[model samples]
Target: MNDLIPLISSSINDTLASLSHFYAEIILAAGFLLVILADLFLSRRFTQLCFLISLSTLLLLGVQSVILLNTKTVFLFGGMLKLDHTSILFKLLFCFSSLLFAIFIRYNSPLQKHVKGTGDLFAILLATLLGMNLLAMSMNLLMVYISIEMVSLGSYLMVSYISADKAQTESAMKYALFGAVCSAIMLYGISLLYGFTGTLNFNDPAFINALKNVSGLSSGVAISLVFIGVAFKLSIAPLHFWAPDVYEGAPTPVTAFLSTAPKIAGFAILIGLLPVFQSEGGQTNTQYFDFNVILAVLATASMLIGNFTAIWQNNVKRMLAYSSIGHTGFMLMALFAFQGSGFQALIFYMAVYIVMNMAAFLIVDEIEEQTGILLIDEYKGMGKSNAMLMTTFVIVLVSLTGLPPTVGFTAKFLVFSSAFEAYRNTDSAVILIMIITAAISTLVSLFYYFKIPLNAFLRNSQIQVMAPGNSPKAYLGLLLAILLLVLIVFPSVIVKLI
Candidate 1:
């Protein structure tokens, strides 16, 4: 009896311990189940039940995150997952952006009228956010692979969610095929890594220590191969072939979500992976510098391609798609500058990026809702009429172009400073080139970014459409944009927390 009592107490304590560390995910997962059930039952009676469920869940998760504010602990079945400051920061961002995304979908999307599976869309988004939260905290290869697939599958489905048109269906098909191929390649790479290192845990001291014995070429290949999966998520240059078509075809809200949240989470995973794979002693046993060189080259290519090609784009969403690729290059700069203190920079940059991109897309959807127009040229002369929308758009675009008095500028400055610090410390030639190229690209971006306002306020067109609507959603986005500017002035609030 005495032995059994001790056993019972220990078991109960262990269960409580596990549950406590997972509060944020617990809130999100519970919300997911509630959303699924709500869609099953209430969606027939109330049109907004699923959206409300998703929003409620996100709100609960945010509250849970605040509750667990400073507690950093690893939880789950074993040492396979972690919830630290870094992971918590990303999770908070994911939840916050998801909240905004839900609003965007609710207000501007044609999904409510056109799509049959919106309930499914919300459920899938919840599940994908779960995957992203896990991806941020994963300490094992198995979790990494699972989380990646979860996000990929969710993305593929979202791309196809409104497949009522040929272009939409074709975009979905391309995204599906491309995503599957990348996952397969990534799986093979993970297998190679597991075989070489004989362990699946990324955070285990033993696993990293064992990696030292592996051949440099083998390690580099394995590491780069693993990043292929992540690169697919971020849509950096080489892996970016599908971005434009998919962005143009998908529901604009999904495009907005895809362009921001999951990509940032993917970069978080890359940061987690890179430190373990860094070669010691500068011995250079491997020919490739793994992700650093690959990402540097990709950033340079992305900057050139994303900028020059965007200059030719007439469609607003498609233009933003390429612009997102360009932003990927800037984010990569943060990755390169990732020495100590760079992690904070990366997190802050991601937060600002989310706010900036979501706000930009919100405006896109708002304009589309009011005027039924989608082209940059269609925006001509509206800057004079849609004063509020255009002013917000201009502020957001200026941030994207990395100008002052916006969070975008601060984020860019943070990353550039980190890169400069890296160069100062190491004098690496690659760092030098990345800095110069990023500086030049920042200038090039102003040309295309200004085109929207230039056409709206400066250029002439017969695009005399109805005035923009007085939407609560648009105002909400504007409020968030204002908060972003506030953060830009006082970045330390977020930076200190990160």
Candidate 2:
């Protein structure tokens, strides 16, 4: 009994030590609390207080993350959490995304016209950021479940906040209900995994080693079941039914944030989990499951479905949503090819994706604000009157289509090349399929992405147009678009970092 007491005390001390490594996340949580309080008491007096607080909080968090970049450390609160480079990268991305989101909300939230409590929106965003950061570090299945639900709940609230129409409300309702069901299923999967392995840490080397020893069917069910929640977050094909509707119905900025940040987090979690499936005694351990083939098939399906479905979307935001899914497929391809240098390529693609999507949505919101139009056809003759904005929009769309001399093209090339390398090394049929499918989908994407330029430049409209409003924020967004344009030519700027 005395020996057990000392062991218990030692475990407690180790846990506390690990918690210190996550000081950045702790600070973020505190910021979230402070934002809520300031929103309630200080927002009325200081118009921009909530925004300032949120932005400052994320900025500081970003700094904190950068400080820990080269450190490799993991701490488990009794085997529930793990922190390391992977989690740090995820948190950094979340911080950058949150900052962009705040800028987006300030400039053009769809709810701005009708909503009174944007302060709540910022707070929810912070809360979601907190969850995603935790998700990157989660090793336990229960921790994974909790972190995912936390982010999902925050996302639903953000979507429903100050919704202007029945459609938006309906979208939020669908999201909440669907997300709840997915969470419940994932919880069950976690329970099964815990029961099978008697441990919850997916990243714990020993835990995963134990899990692999389980019955073949049990391991497959456990892994596939856990992937359900991630697939939902990623908007992958089978679980992607909610994406277009949610993206179309949510405010444009929210749509942009939703499409990018959470997807990146999900990918990080996937990266953390994939190596665990590389069972010992060769890759043919189980007849019913081949992890690589499953991911490859999902990638193929996501690319095909996302690109083809996008071809049918007239609403700009909806098209971007499907496009985001297609991008997810591309990222999955990277996931397949992931090794030492793959991290660089993945970060490069995600950064460029965020810039492109944010800029595209900003333009959507700007056009809507000026012309009160949301359809692609409504963009007719916009090129002539809104020449500057349309020019910026064309650049962004071209990048999205992955044309030459664009950052998107560079990102795709790296991913494709890496996959090709993986194929050469292994000659895996699955890798070949993924590469070919992704290439074809890129071509398919070109058809719809070009529609933006076609409508703006070639099509004509009878309606007269007015000058764009004098908003500096719009110019800033255009400047951001220009930055992406520059990134295409100067890809090394971001590529060298990761």
Candidate 3:
């Protein structure tokens, strides 16, 4: 009893001391509460108040995350969470993406015109942001499950919040059911992992040691089950079926948020789990099935499936959804090939990807609003009417295609170069296959991505339309497009930060 008292007291002291490092999350939680209260009590009088609060909260969180970037790595909450450069980097990414989402939601007409207004959406955004933040920093299996569920529930709510039609409701239902199944599988896997290892901390030596001694078949099953949930979140192949439906059905702003922030958080979780396949000497764990090979196959499959499938998509949102899956493939390759400074490459690619995707979606949403066109064929003759917007869209698409003189090119180069380096170092055929698959997928993506421009510029519309005038969304997207060009010229800016 005496020993128990001392241990409990020490834990309390440690948790209290951890509070300082946890201030940003505390602020996010507080902001979420405040937004809820505002929505309840003040929303009638102040239409834009929730949006303001949400944006401010995200901006503040971004600033705090940047400040924390300088701090050395530390474990908090008795090792349930980690504060490190990687976590801080991803937290900042989520913060920036959420901030942009707030802006995107503010200017979205459908969400604004909904009976419930955008206040609830803002609250949901904060909740989702909180989940992503937790997901990035989580260091334990329990934290992993809780954080993923937090993000998933918030996502389900966001999708269903403004269900204006059957499609939206259907998408939400599919997402919930699919996500529930994945979560159940993941929980079962975690249970089996705990049963085998008697520990939930993947970073713990005991966990790896147990895997080393356990039957390869059992460990492989457990790992594959856990990855099923991660793959769903990432929208990788074989589990990517829900992405197109959800992306097409959800509001464009919500889709934008879904494609960027949650995907990045998924990568953060994958990065956290990578150590399980690594040894203290920084070599692959030969005793287990080579996770790199498995990831490489997944990456290759995602790229091939995503890019090839996108070619047949006429709906712009669905195409981008598949493109996102293709990008996931590239990121998985980066993860498989991770070496010293390779993380920098991954972060850089992710940061650029966020900018490019948000900009593309912003343009898509604006075009959809102005012309009520969602299909590629409908984009015909829009170039002459909405020249500036289409031009920006072209630039963003070019970036997405990873063409030169754009940040996307630089980002892709870094990832591919890192993979090549890994191939050279380890002589792994899987790494080489990933590089080839990435190249082929990039080529495949060009066909669909170019369809946007080809239809907009080359074809003539059946009906004439007035030009789209300047709007905040258009300007925001243009600014992002210009930022991409700037990044190409000065790639070091983001590189140095990472």
Worst 10 residues of 1 by lDDT: 279-288
Question: Which sections of candidate 1 miss by over 4 Å?
Answer: 1-16, 115-117, 279-284, 287-291
Model 2 Cα lDDT, one tens digit per residue, 381-474? 8888888888888888888888866677888888888788778877999889889998899999989998988998998889877756636546
Predicted candidate 3 versus true structure: per-residue lDDT over 280-329, tens digit per residue: 22324344566777778888999999999999999999999999999999
Model 1 agreement with the true structure over 1-498: per-residue lDDT tens digits: 776886787767766777768767777778889888988888889989899889888888888776666885666656678777778888889888898888887886578786474788889899999999999889899999999888888888888888888988999999999989998999999999888778898777777666666777777787778878878988988899899999998888999999988898888788778766564225545454555666678888887788778989999999999989988877787766576657777788888888888998888888888787799878888877788888888888988898988888888888888878877877878778988888888898899999998988897666466684568767976887787778777888887667
Worst 10 residues of 2 by lDDT: 276-285
**Clash pairs detected, candidate 3:** none
- In order, the Cα lDDT scores of the candidates are 0.82, 0.82, 0.89
Q: Name the lDDT value of residue 71 in candidate 2.
A: 82
Number of clashes recorded per candidate: 0, 0, 0
Better of 1 and 3 by TM-score: 3
Using TM-score as the measure, what is the rank order of every candidate, best first? 3, 2, 1
The model with the greatest TM-score is: 3
Top-lDDT candidate index: 3
Instruction: List pairs with backbone clashes in candidate 2.
Output: none
Off by over 4 Å in 2: 1-4, 76-79, 277-285
Q: What does candidate 2 score on TM?
A: 0.95
TM-scores of all predicted structures: 0.94, 0.95, 0.97
